[model samples]
Target: MAKEMQKTSMFIERNPGDCENGDICKNLDDDGRVKRTGTWVTASAHIITAVIGSGVLSLAWAIAQLGWVAGPAVLMAFSFITYFTSTLLADCYRAPDPVHGKRNYTYMDVVRAYLGGRKVQLCGLAQYVNLLGVTIGYTITASISMVAVKRSNCFHKHGHHVKCQTSNNPFMVIFACIQIVLSQIPNFHNLSWLSIIAAIMSFAYSSIGLGLSIAKVAGGEHARTTLTGVTVGVDVSGSEKIWRTFQAIGDIAFAYAYSTVLVEIQDTIKSSPPENKSMKRATTLGVSTTTIFYVLCGLVGYAAFGNEAPGNFLTGFGFYEPFWLIDFANICIAIHLIGAYQVFAQPLFGFI
Candidate 1:
C-alpha cells in the first residue's frame, strides 16, 4: 500500500516544482513510455515462438483420431479462442490511466488488477504449474525426437517384446542445463533475436513435415484416406469412443494454450506511440502463422500415416528418402523447445 502511494505521488508530482528531488522523480517517469520499446516484428517472433512448440508435433495424431472434419474444426476453434484471449492480454498492458498508467509486465499483474490478491496467487500457481508441464512436455518431445533420429530400424517382431531401455533423463538434463543459463538472460526483451530464430525454426520443421507428407503421397507410398469416419454429425458408438473424442478435444485445446505468458510477451512491445498497437499486431501474426502450420501439418500428417499415426509425428512418420531431413527437423524441434522453455520460464522466474 505504501509503495502504491509513493508511485501515485510520484506521478502526481511529475510536474517541475512539486518534487524536491526533481532529477530522481523525473527519472522515475516509470510510465508506459519507457516500457514500450520492443520492435513489433521481434515481438511477433517471440509470440510465435511461444505459441508453436512441441504441441504441433502431436497435432497430427489428434487429427487422425478425431478424423479430418472434427480435427480441423477443433484447431480453428482454438485458433480463434487463443487469438482473442491473447489480444485481451495486450489490452491489459495499460490499466485506466487513473489507476496505474504504467505497463503490466506479467500475467499475474493483470489478474491482480482485475481479480484481486487471491486470484493473483492462483494465477501464479497456475502459471508455474503450466510452465513446469511445458518444460516436461518439451523434454519428452525432444528426447523422443532424438531417439527417433538415432533409431537404426523398427523391424522388431510384433508380440516379441524387446526392452528398448530408453531413458529421456539424459536429454532432459541437457536441456535443463541450457535453460539454467538461458533463463538467466534476465528478460524477454533480450531474447528478440533468439525468438526470431526459434520462430523460423518452427516454420522449418512444420514445412518439412508437410513436404514429406506430400512427397509420400506423390510417391504412392502414403494413404489419403482417413482411418476413422469423417462424416459430419455421425454419432460415435459407445462410451469409449465418446471419451476418446473428448480426449482429442482436450489435446487440441492444450496445443493452443499459451495465455499464461501473453502479458509477459506484451510487456516487450512498446507503448511509446501513445496508441501503441504492436502487441495486438504481434498476437495476430503469431496466432495466424501457427494456425496455418497446424492445419497443414494435421491434414498432411493424417493423410501420410492414416490411423497408424503415432503420438509423436517425427518418430511415427519415417520418410527415409533423403533421411537427412528427418534429422534436421528433429534438431530444429530441440532448438525450438529450448527457446520455448525460456519464454515460459522467464515469467515464472519473475513471479518467484
Candidate 2:
C-alpha cells in the first residue's frame, strides 16, 4: 500500500504544478536545495573545443612559412592575451548572476552593465558581423572536409586541388545541414559531453601523428612533400620574397588560431570551485597537458613536412594509408570547428 502511494505521488509530481490559492516549492527539490552537477573535465572539454577549430589543420602551413622558432613564441604571447581577456569577461558575469538571481548572464548584459545605452547598441551591431563571419568559416571548413573525403575516394571526378564550393555541391550542403540539425537536437549538456569526446580524439590525433612523424624522421625519411597550397592575390617580387613572407607570418597565424580558446578556458576556470590545492593543481595540469600536446603536434608536423609540407599539417604527418584514422581525424576536426563557432558566435549572437 505504501509503494502504491509513493508511485502515485511521483506521477503527480512529474506533471506541471497546480496551485489553488496556494504556494509552491521554490527550490524544486524534494530536499529543498539546488545541486551543482558538472566536473572540471566537462568544463575543460568545453573550453578546449572553444579554443580549437578548423585552424588546427591550417597550423602546419602557417608554421612552415615562419620557421620553427616563431611558432612557440607566438603561442605563448597569445596565451597571455587570451587569458587576460577571458578572466575579465568571467568577472563581469559573476556579479549579474548573483544580483538578479539569473542562471546565466549573456554578453549583452555585460555590455549593458558596463557601457550602457548606445554603447550596448553599437556592441550588438559588431556582434552581428562577428557571428556571421564565424558561421561562414565553420560552414566552409565542414565543406572542405567533405570534399576532401570525396576526392580521397578514387571517384577522381577532379584532382585534389579543386576548391570546395558550396554552391556547386548540393549534397555537401545537405550533409552539413544534417550535422547542424543534429548539433541543435542535442541539448547543451549532451553537446558538452560530445565536446569532451572530441577533445580527447583531438589530443589522441595530435599525439599519434606527432609520434609517427618523429619515428619517420629518425629512420631517415625527411617527408618533404606538399599536400596542399593556397594562392593569395598579393603579388610577390619573386619566389624568395614569397618564401620570406611565409617564414614571417605562417607559424604565427596557425598558432594564433589554435590558442584563441585559452581565453575561454580561463573564463571557465575562474568560476569553478577551489576548496583545496587540487583545484589549482588541476588547472595547472590541464594547461600543461594542452601545451605539451600543441608542442608535440608542431614538432612532428615540422619534421615530417619540412618546407614543402602541406598547409594542413596532419595530412602527411601521420603514417601513410591509415585511411580510417585520416577520415576520423577529419570528421572530429570538422565537429570541433563547429563548437569553436558556437562559442565565438554565441556571444556575438547575444549582441545581435
Candidate 3:
C-alpha cells in the first residue's frame, strides 16, 4: 500500500492534471474535468430561468383560491423553504470536502457519493421522474402560450365575440423541434447564454403581467376579493374551497421547485471563493428575485381581478385592449419556456 501510494504521488507530481482514477486531463479543471467558468451571476440566471416559469402564470389564480391571507403567506413560506434547501443542496456539489473534494457533476452523483446504496438508485429515479414531469409541463405550457398568441391576434382581427380558438398540437410540435436543436448543446456550462436569455424573457412576461394588473387596479376596475379568498358558499362549496386551497398551496410550492437542479447549477460555478458560498448567494438572489415577482404578480393580479382572475392573466385574456402587449407577453412566455425546458431536461439527458 505504501509503494502504491508512492507511485501515485510520483505520477501526480509528473502529471499534475491527472487523477488516480485516470479521469480526463485535457482542458481539465482542478478536479480533472472540463474547467468551470460559471460565476454566481450565471448560476443565478440559471436558477431564475428554472424557478420562474409557467408556474408564475398561475399565481393569480392560486391567490384567488387561497385568498389575501393564505395566498401571500404560502408564497413566502415556499420561497423560504426553497432557498434554505437549495443552499444545503449546493454544498453537496462536492463531497467529503466541499471546497476541494471530488466534484459530483450531477445530483445523482452527489447521492451516490454521500448516500450510497439503494438510496442512490431511488433518488436517481425520483430526480429523473421529476425532471421528466417538469419538461412535459413546460412543453404544454409553451404550447399554450403559443396558442394564446395566435388566439390574441385572432381576437384582435375578428373582434372579442368571435371564438378565436387555436389548436395546441402544432405549437407543441414546434416546441419539440426547438428542443431537439437545443438539446445538441454540449452540456450545462455551455447553457449560460440560453439561461440568461430565458431569465430576461421570464422578467419580461412577469413585468408585463404586473403592469397590466396595476393598470386594472388604477382604473378602479378591481374584482371582488376577501381576506380569506374565494367565498365558501358563494364562490364555491365548502369542500370545493378546501380542495382549491390545497391546489393553490401546491401551485405555490411548485413555483419554487428548482432544488432538483440545484447541485448541477452549483457544479458549473468557479472553484474560487468556494462553490458553496457562491451558490448560497446565487440561491438567495434568485429566490428573492422570484419571490418579489411572485408577490407583485400574485397579489396585484388578485387585487385586480380577485375571485374572477383567469388561470393565466395574459393567456386568459385578462387584458384585451392592449392586444399587442398581451401578444408580446405570451410570446415571451413561449420563449422563456423554450429555454427552461432545456434547463430541466439537461440533467435527465446527462443521466441517460
Worst lDDT run of 10 residues, candidate 1, spans: 152-161
Query: Per-residue lDDT of 245-345 in model 3, one digit per residue for the tens?
Result: 89889888888898889888988998888999999999999999999999999999999998978888888888886888998999999999999999998
Ordered from best to worst lDDT, the candidate numbers read 3, 1, 2
Give the clashing pairs for model 2: 51-261, 62-250, 62-251, 65-246, 65-247, 66-247
* Model 3 alpha-carbon miss at residue 197, Å: 0.3
Among all candidates shown, the one with the greatest TM-score: 3
Cα distance off (Å), candidate 2, residue 289: 4.2
For every model shown, the clashing-pair count is 3, 6, 1
Candidate 3 has an lDDT of: 0.88
After superposing candidate 2 on the true structure, give the runs of residues whose Cα lies further than 4 Å from its correct spot. Answer: 1-36, 96-104, 155-171, 183-190, 223-289, 315-320, 338-352
The local lDDT score (0 to 100) that residue 131 gets in candidate 2 is 54
Q: What is the C-alpha lDDT of each candidate?
A: 0.72, 0.51, 0.88
In angstroms, the error of model 1 at 128 is: 1.9
C-alpha TM-scores of all predictions: 0.83, 0.66, 0.93
| Tens digit per residue, CA lDDT, model 2, 1-352 | 9967643443244224443333443322222222224356665676566555555545555545555676556556655554445445544543454322222235555677767999987876665665567567667766666555544443234534554333426645755676566555323333455667667756655655566567767889764432222223332235755775565454444333322223233223322353112223433444456556665665566666666556564433233335455566666665666555555554443333
How big is the positional error of residue 130 in model 1, measured in Å on the Cα after superposition?
1.2
